[model samples]
Target: MELFVDLQIASENQADLPSLTLIEQWVCIAIDAGSSKTRKEAELTVRIVDSEESQQLNGDFRAKYKPTNVLSFPFQNPPGITLPLLGDLVICKQVVEKEAMEQNKSLNAHWAHMLIHGTLHLLGYDHIIEEDAVEMESLETKLVLQLGFPAPYNEQE
Candidate 1:
């Protein structure tokens, strides 16, 4: 599978952001574990922004007026158009860093989790319902563990 990741840094603080290679690897891992298609070409963007942009997007799209860790916007193609576009993931660098520090997790590990979670969202995995949450969280744990990171949910809870 050929995957393209467009990394966009809109945040002034680039302190703990992961590299494009690591971001691509995390996205690929999630896609491989969640997507049904194996050999299709896909592209996604990872846009890192400050809390203000994140809060605006969250308020606009989700109606929550707070800065969120990550927001996934899945691309919806027209009926007859088959594009390789997956979607865009807007991550709040400040929130993520604060979360990592609060959760006592490595910066890279949390970043990987966010990317994997967002990519899974792009592939139609969600945690709104209990069953789906279990499935999605289980897959996420498996993938994160495979990457040698601590279990994210356990730490969060």
Candidate 2:
């Protein structure tokens, strides 16, 4: 799968994260897990927006007033065809940084986790239910490990 990542850092905070290549690697792993082998050559965009913009989107679409670390807007296009346009992943830079610091994780690791999480959402994965959450988190953990990061849920336990 050919992955294209467009990262935009709106925050002025100085935190050195992984390069785009690493992001693409994590995204590809997530996408590969969520999609079938037949459905290849997909395109998706990932933008790192600010907390204010994330709050606006969360309020508008999710009906929540607070800013989220990541939001996925999947393209509900027609099914059963070639060359799929997955959708977009919007990541709140400020929220991610704050969450990372609060969770006692490195910025790069958190960034990879969030990006992988959002990309999975784009591919129609969700953690709304307990079973689904387990499935999603399992897949995320594997992909994150492949990206050289620790399990995202390890800190929670």
Candidate 3:
């Protein structure tokens, strides 16, 4: 539970949707939910950006010309440094809020889910394939629920 979150607010868009404490909490939940204990004392960066910035990064890095709710960039440490830097997470506040409203999810819950999702991605969990998707999504659901949030992928009623 000794994780440190370096929060960076690059945009004055959304009233700091997920406060630093909440971000750290969800990141810790996701990290602790993992099988490896290596990330017990990890470090990562969380940047809140505008839609334009998100779209730029997404397009440049992922070849997608849209703003994503959350994007994860895992760190690749060099040979000598023992820094426990995991990676970075870029969150688009506008997209997150819009998605929450559209998906009928509580703003905070969706924020927590997105933060958890990005943290898991930093921890090397992905839904690129069927099996990996199941495992990653299941883990996300369990962690979110344990953190007092509803299942993120529940069918919209």
**What does candidate 3's lDDT look like per residue over 42-149, in tens digits?**
899999999999999999999999999999999988988777788999999999899889988899999999998999999888999989989999998998889887
Q: Candidate 2 at residue 121, lDDT? A: 91
Candidate 1 C-alpha error for residue 105, in Å: 0.4
Q: Tell me the TM-score of model 3.
A: 0.93
> 1 or 3: which has the higher lDDT?
1
The sequence of per-residue lDDT tens digits that candidate 1 reaches over residues 110-148 is 999999999999999999999999999999999999999
Best by TM-score: 1
Question: What is candidate 3's CA lDDT for residue 149?
Answer: 78
Runs of candidate 3 with Cα error greater than 4 angstroms are: 38-40, 155-157
RMSD of each: 1.0, 2.2, 1.8
Native-vs-model 3 lDDT?
0.88
- Residue 153, model 1: lDDT of 92
Two-way TM-score contest, 2 vs 3, winner = 3
Q: How much is the lDDT of residue 106 in candidate 3?
A: 91
lDDT rank, highest first? 1, 3, 2
**Ten-residue stretch with the least lDDT total in model 2:** 9-18
